[model samples]
Target: MSDAAAPGQPVLADLTTIGVGGPAVRLVEPTTGDELLAAARDAFTSDEPWFVLGGGSNLVVADDGFDGTVIRVATRGIEVLSETDDGVRIRVAAGHPWDDLVAETVARGWSGIEALSGIPGSVGASPVQNIGAYGQEVSATVVSADFLDADTLEFVRVPRANMGLAYRTSVFKAGQSHPARPGVITAVEFELHNGGGVSEPVAYAQLASALGVALGDRVPVADVRDRVLALRASKGMVLDPADADTRSCGSFFTNPIVSPEALEGVPADAPRWESSPEAQDVAVPLGELPAPPPPPAPAAVKLSAAWLIEHSGIPRGFSLPGSRAAISSKHTLAITNRGGATAAEVTELARFVQSRVASEFGVLLHPEPILLGAFL
Candidate 1:
């Protein structure tokens, strides 16, 4: 582990997708699990604050930068611990690129994650964020995650049930507010199906339409992966150095799960979805669409944040006059860095968007990225 800063050392901006943050006071990149644990232990033991950076896809750091140690999880490996007729259980190192695992799984006929293609980040960030897209979430297949508990400085394995998996969050991401042990994840295990190379049934409507199939249809895993990648790329969700729209956190805000009463003023045409995992997984009847449900008291409904933002008069690509930060041109959910934008500019734009949505819809949107030394 090296903590010395050099004249041309990389800054947090250079490491992050949005390219906005300042430099790390001390940077630690561990390429092995043992090194990662040691580095984490040292950081935790130190008086200085610290953060574990993954693939850097879902972070927004302040322009002033992190004042303490920043440990980058860079370990890599994929190990199959067991296999059966039904499925295969594999353990992945925390630093492994997330999409690389998805691609590998699809190529090997492992069907669980085919629908989650094109998401950027490290495998370790999966359970932490409970990352989901196109109707697939890591919680559905994750068996366990190994961690080096900071409080005790002992390594432990946490089962899926103990992770507190929820929409876009888990115990790992909850920080001090949660009762669960806090630590840095070292690896994750997942059980993926071997369904004769076929993917799980398509549960999301858009994905089904893209594949020219009805909901509940099963297609080749490779095909599912290909289409998902294409869809994400078109929306600027995929990482591309040439695409300025991709220079931001994948999504700036989480889809708010709110009381039905919060939707009182939202337009009847606004999109809504059931917030429960089971409900979200069920496919709608082919060729039939249900009318929007009226706001029902006590039932949680997930609203489309994009719809709210757009309806609030914030169009895609909207930017404050002369500001370097702007909404993504391809998708309204992201706030992009036009060029050399600072974290302050990004947060300013974010606050503007939040105010508009809250004023127009009476519902507040929460940021999806892990902000370091940054506030909304």
Candidate 2:
């Protein structure tokens, strides 16, 4: 329940993990339910361009700074509503860090979101983008996400089915943020597995193979989390400020799921699966060729966006002359800040990659993070 910045107080850069962006116009941290609700409704009534800023991880703010009020959802809580052999019902505050909730659930031997172990950002934002990692997305287990219906100015806890969780997007993430159209997510509720200590059947082939086990194997929940974290750490997906690769917002683009026709357009050796050059080639060749002479890339395949970027001739760390920002040297999907780069500069580099990928692969790559002030 703190007041907005008084005067000299600096903005998000001091607190955000990204280490960039200009000062926020106004930053409000609402610790109580009434405060959060009042601030949201007030901004709505006044026609203020308000955004519910959370974890600040999966966001890229512009250089000019947000020119409107920013409601920082600092409201926090995590409670076990029920426990049983079938499932566990629990509710989490929107402001809670996503990984913290995952860890807590895993620690208590819960088996729903363990595979989303290393993802960054807030619980509220999870439903917004359907935060995903390894083989698990928050959408798979979310029973409901509670939000203040900005339109009606009332509490509405929409069911998971109504949230519209796609590969890595949702209604909240897909809509515009104007007075006429804004989705202010407040909290989320999940129903996790309490069926003994067994995990959900492993879905990702890479994950199953890494555990030296076959697909559909149900290993210990803890082991799955441990293995997933190790893999993400290697790719700098898990946060590490010292390493520039980690200085990125995880994977920049989602793995493209192309139509059957789109699949046929792609070549046989095209880096198809995510995670590697050879692995993609291997995944396709392992099974019998799909019918229809192999359309673009089937909805059957998850094309590696990083491979597309590299093959597009924009190698990691490749930047135009005299630019501080560039692609990450460790991975191509991540566009990095090589120190002293402004938000606009980052935006420019991002556009360049998208343009190049379009020209090269004929696939338009979309940004995965929340971009403010300008489109990514």
Candidate 3:
């Protein structure tokens, strides 16, 4: 465990993808899982407020910065736990780079995560957000994770069935319920298919169009990754040091999930999808009569935040006059720092966008990024 005090100033602005935020009072970087667990334990036992920092892609720190201890895990390893004829079960250290893991899996013909190519963040943070893209969600492949339970201060293994994973959120996230236990993830296990050099069938329409293939076509695994990266780069979703537009926490707002009736206020042509299909499959025992079906469950609707923002008159590349914070020129879903933008500016712009969408469509937009010492 590297308990050595950080030298000089340690500003979060230098660590995060977005060029904002102030300095941390103390920063600890653990190079191994044991060290990470140790650091987490120490933080938990102390009274100081602390947080685990991952890739810093889905976080926004206030200009005043976090006055608490910050634990940054640097543990690294990818182990093949088990292998069978059709699939491979592997475990990854929480600190492993997520895209690198995807690349490695695709190169080895593992098909489950091919569509999640260019997402930025660490493996540890993946399940917390149930990260997804191009119709491939991490929840679909995650098998289990090892963690240092915050409540008990003990290490435990949690299975996927208890994760409470849903669109863009999990029990590990704040304001969420932990079916198993809330803790700091130390490692994650995934079950990946041996695709024989092909990818999962195309599930997202945009991805299918980019690959010049119809939905359900299984392109080469490498090709899917290449196209996914290209798509992300085009939208400024991929991180790039030279692209100012890429200097942001990818999507500022999560698509608003609303009851079907609540969507009546939205435009008829607005892009919306059913969050979950009503369950219909049923079974009857041999020689036993089938029972009548119960009432169908109501399906929730997910409205596109980008479409709502655009329709509410907030266009891409928009910014408050004389303010450095602005909406990404490539994607309205992101609020960007033009350079030297403050947390106040970012929140101001976020609030403005939210107010506009709410007034126009009667729908409230919630931020996808975790705001530390800031609110929207």
Candidate 4:
């Protein structure tokens, strides 16, 4: 990060998969744990807007730009804290690349996060959204997270119960509404099964079919990780700069859940599924699905976000306002900056998609990325 501006280095264009955003006021990269702590502490007291920049994957900053300190979490450390015949415990620094960690864990014969392979971001951000894919969420394997309390500046440990994990939310996300803590994620601890794949079953159908295994079937950890990466790459969910479809912050919207009454009204053609076991409600079509030939159109149940966007008339490559930002032609869910678009241009695209989908399907789309300057 020291050579941040050594000529021909359009930092944002190269760093983020989306290829947008302005230059940082000052970029802080701490290579060690102590350094990270010190940087956070200094930012805590400095009269400047501080953002704990992680992987810089899941972000949409304004072109007008952030007029504050950008503390990039660059600390690097990973270790097997302890192990047993049944399980292995691991510790990963927040700054570690999430997908790389998954690959390493699978390579070592540990299961649990294999299904989350290829997801772009820092290890710390995984807990923020409980990042999930192929039917497995990081929350399932996370034993606890060691974080720096944004307010008190003391290192605090948030266990599973206190983590407030849910559909794309956690204690820090929901709790932040009440008040802001230093909210800096420092490290994550995971207890993974050592026997075969993982204790948590594979729930996404695409993954099962891709691996030629049944839903809930356990496969080799490496195989699961590989298949998950392939599946993600197919949908542009994986970060691949060469592919326009991947010029996005992964999925743009969370799959919308509906109440039982709402489900009753959806067209019979939509996928209908449920979120939990005890809940007496069914999930119906909410959006579009990526082009994966074998999955039988996802049933008329839990509607795929990609499908909803397409059906809503927002096809890939859709754009507006004479801007380069466009929805990737390969996947409707991802809106790309097309090499030179600004945050404002992307927001315009997002707003247009949101309006179109909500009007057509009556389902409001919430952006997956955390917006710093604007909201729809």
lDDT of each: 0.85, 0.73, 0.84, 0.72
**Model 4 spans > 4 angstroms off:** 1-14, 174-180, 196-200, 263-265, 276-302, 374-376
Instruction: Please give the TM-score that candidate 1 achieves against the real structure.
Output: 0.91
Q: What lDDT is obtained when candidate 3 is compared to the true structure?
A: 0.84
Q: Write down the worst ten-residue block by lDDT for model 1.
A: 278-287
lDDT per residue as tens, model 3, 1-376: 1112256757887778886777788899999987998999999888978888899998888877777888987889999998877999999999999999998998898899999999999999999999999989999999999989888898989899988887787878864322534568999999999868788889999999999999999999999999999999999999988888999999988787777766667889999888763222232221123355345447767788899999999999999999999999999999998898987788889888988888888887777777775331
Error of 2 at 241 (Å): 2.6
Question: After superposition on all CA atoms, what RMSD does each candidate show versus the true structure?
Answer: 7.1, 7.5, 8.5, 6.9
Candidate 3: residue 2 Cα off by (Å): 26
TM-score of each: 0.91, 0.86, 0.91, 0.86
| Candidate 2 global CA lDDT score | 0.73
How big is the positional error of residue 349 in model 3, measured in Å on the Cα after superposition? 0.6
Clashes per model (N, Cα, C within 3 A): 0, 11, 0, 21
Please give the lDDT score at residue 41 for candidate 3: 92
Error of 3 at 182 (Å): 4.0
lDDT of 2 by residue, 1-376 (tens): 1223347654655455555576666778888767888888887776557678888887777665666778888888898999997899999998889889988888888898988988888888888888877678888889988788777787888898877676776777733221122657777899999957678889888799878888888988889889998888877777887886676667766676555445554567886543311112111111123122222232345677888788888877798778777787777877777777666677778778877876776665667666765432
Off by over 4 Å in 2: 1-9, 175-181, 271-301, 374-376
